[model samples]
Target: MNENLFAPFITPSIMGITTLPIIIMFPCLILSTPKRWIPNRIQTLQMWLIRLITKQMMTMHNKLGRTWTLMLMSLILFIASTNLLGLLPYSFTPTTQLSMNIGMAIPLWMGTVLMGFRNKPKASLAHFLPQGTPTPLIPMLIIIETISLFIQPLALAVRLTANITAGHLLIHLIGSATLALSSISMTVSSITFMILFLLTILEFAVAMIQAYVFTLLVSLYLHDNS
Candidate 1:
C-alpha cells in the first residue's frame, strides 16, 4: 500500500527506457502544424496564449533582452505542460525531481550570468558591492552578495521540486484515505472524496502558477543582466 501510494513520484521506465523525454516532448506536439492559412480553434487559442505570455514576459525587458522571447516562451510552455500532464492518472511528474530541476536551472541561470560578465563585466562585478557601502562592511557585503548570487539557481530548483512534491504527496495521502474509509463509512468517505476533488482543482492552478513564477523569475534575471 505504501509503495503504491508513493509510486506516482517514481520516474517510470520500461525495459530500461525512461519516459521523461517522452513526457517532455508531449507538450510540443500540440503546437505542430500542417500549413493551414487559417488556424482552427485549438491552434488559434494556442497562438493567443503564446502571444500573451510573450508580451507579458517581455514587458520589463529591454531591446537586447527581447532576443530571449522564444527561449523564455518555450520554457514556460514546456513547464506548464509538464506540470499539467503530471496530474493525469498513472502519469509521472518530472518537475518533482530535484536533479532534473537543478539540471535545468543551473545551465540557464549560468548562461545569464555569463552573458552579463561577457557584455558588461564592470557592471556585473559592481553588483557585488552597492554604491556608498560602508568601508568596514564592504568585504562582508561582497561575500554575502556572492553567496546570494550562487543561491539563486539552487533556490529555483528546490522551490519547484518541493512545491510539486508536496502537492502530489498530499493528493496521494488524501486519496488513499478516501479509499480506505469508503469501506467503513460512506459519509466520511464521501466528504474525503470531495476534499480530494477540490484539492485536485487547486493543484491544477498551482501547476500553472508555479510554471509562470519560474519563467517570470528567469525573465527578471535576464532583464537585470541585459
Candidate 2:
C-alpha cells in the first residue's frame, strides 16, 4: 500500500511546509523544559512535558558536559525520517513548500529575539548594534543588522523550500518522461526506472542533510543568544 496516500498517511495533510515546525517543535519543547514542575497539576501540561524532556537532557549534560553529539544526532534522525517518509512514490515532500520552512524558521527567529531580550534586557539593542561604535556608524550598523535579522528567517525558509521542491519536480519530470517512453518499450523504461530509483534514494540523503543543516543553524543562533 502507498501509505503516503492512505487513510492514516493523508498526503495533503502531511505534505505541507507548515507542519514541520510543529512536529520539530514538539520534541524540542520537551527537551527544553525543567524537571521539578512535572508533577505539579496546576502547571500546564505543556510545562510538564517540557520539564520531563529537560530533565533527561540535564542528566545527559551532567554526565557529558556541553557536547552536542546527542542533540545533533537526534536532530538529524528526526528531520531525515520525516523527509524520507515524504519521498515515497505518490507521497508529497513537505519540505518542498515554503510555508513549512517558514514555519520552522519563525519559531527559531522568535526564540532568538525573545532570548536576547529576556536574558539581556538592557543589552538586547546593543547586542544587535554592538558597543563603542561611533555615532556616524551606528545608523549604518543598525540598518545592516536589522536587514540581517529580517533576512535570517527568509533565507532559512527559502533555502529548504527551493531544494526540496526542485528535487521533487526533477524526479517527477524524469519519472513521467520515462513512463511515456515505457509504453513504447519495457527495456528502456526499466533502465530509466532503475536510474530514477537511485535518484530517489539520493533524495532521501539530501532530506537528512537539509534537515541537519537547518537544525544546526538554529542551534548556532540559540547558542549565540545564550
Candidate 3:
C-alpha cells in the first residue's frame, strides 16, 4: 500500500511513450487560441488572468528586473499546471520530487546571485560581512552569513516539495479512509467523503498558492539583485 501510494513519485524509464508530457499539456490543451473578434468565456477569462498575473509579477519589477516577466510567468504556469493536474485520478505530480524542485531553484537563484555580483560586486560581497561588527566575531559572522546565503536555493526547493508532498499525502490518506469506511458504516463514510471533498478543494487552492509563492520568491530574489 505504501509503495502504491508513493509509486507516482518514482521516475519512469520507457522506450516507447510516457504520460508525463500529455499531463503537462493538459493545462494548455484546455484553453484555445483566441481567434474570434469578440472574446468568448475562455478567452476573456484568460486575458483577464493574464493581466492580473502580469501585474502581480511585473509591478514591483520596474527596474532592470522588468524583463523577467516572461520567465517568471512561465515558471508560475508550469508549477501551477503540474500541481493542479496532479489532483486528477491517476495523475502524477512532478513538483513533489525534490530533485526537480532543486533543479528549478538552483539555476534561477544562481542567476540572481551572479547578476548581483556582476552589477554590484561590492554590494554582493558586503552581504557576507555586517557593518560595524566586532573584530573578534568577524570570522564567525562571515561563516554564518555565507552558510545562510548558500541555503537559499535549498530552502526554496524544500519548501515547495514539502508543501505539495504533504498536501497530496493528506488527500491520499483521507481518500483511502473514505473508501475503507464505506463497507463499515454508510453514515461515517458519507461524513468522511465530505471531509475528503473539502480537503481536495483546499488542496486545489494550495496548488496555486505554492506555485505563486515559488515564483514570487524567485522574483524577489531577482529584484534584490537587479
- Count of steric clashes across candidates, in order: 0, 3, 0
On TM-score, the candidate that comes out on top is: 1
Candidate 3 residue pairs that clash: none
TM-score of each: 0.95, 0.62, 0.91
Which tens-of-lDDT digit does each residue in 133-174 have in candidate 1?
999999999999999999999999999988999999999999
The 0-to-1 C-alpha lDDT of every candidate, in the order given, reads 0.90, 0.66, 0.87
Better of 2 and 3 by TM-score: 3
Q: Rank by TM-score, descending?
A: 1, 3, 2
- In candidate 1, list every pair of residues with a backbone clash: none
lDDT of 2 by residue, 1-226 (tens): 3323123232344545445445444444433334584545544664554355445433433222335445544655455656776677655555666776688688767876787678767766775688788998998999998889879889988987777776777687778769888899999999899988898888878887787677667666655555
Cα distance off (Å), candidate 3, residue 196: 0.2
Query: So what's the TM-score on candidate 3?
Result: 0.91
Looking at candidate 2, what is the lDDT of residue 188? 91
Candidate 3 per-residue C-alpha lDDT over 1-226 given as tens digits, one digit per residue, 9 for 90 to 100? 2548776676554775765666566676665678879988878986787689989788987577988888888788889988998899977888898988999999999999999999889988998898999999999999999999899999999999999999998888888899999999999999999999999999999999999999999998998888
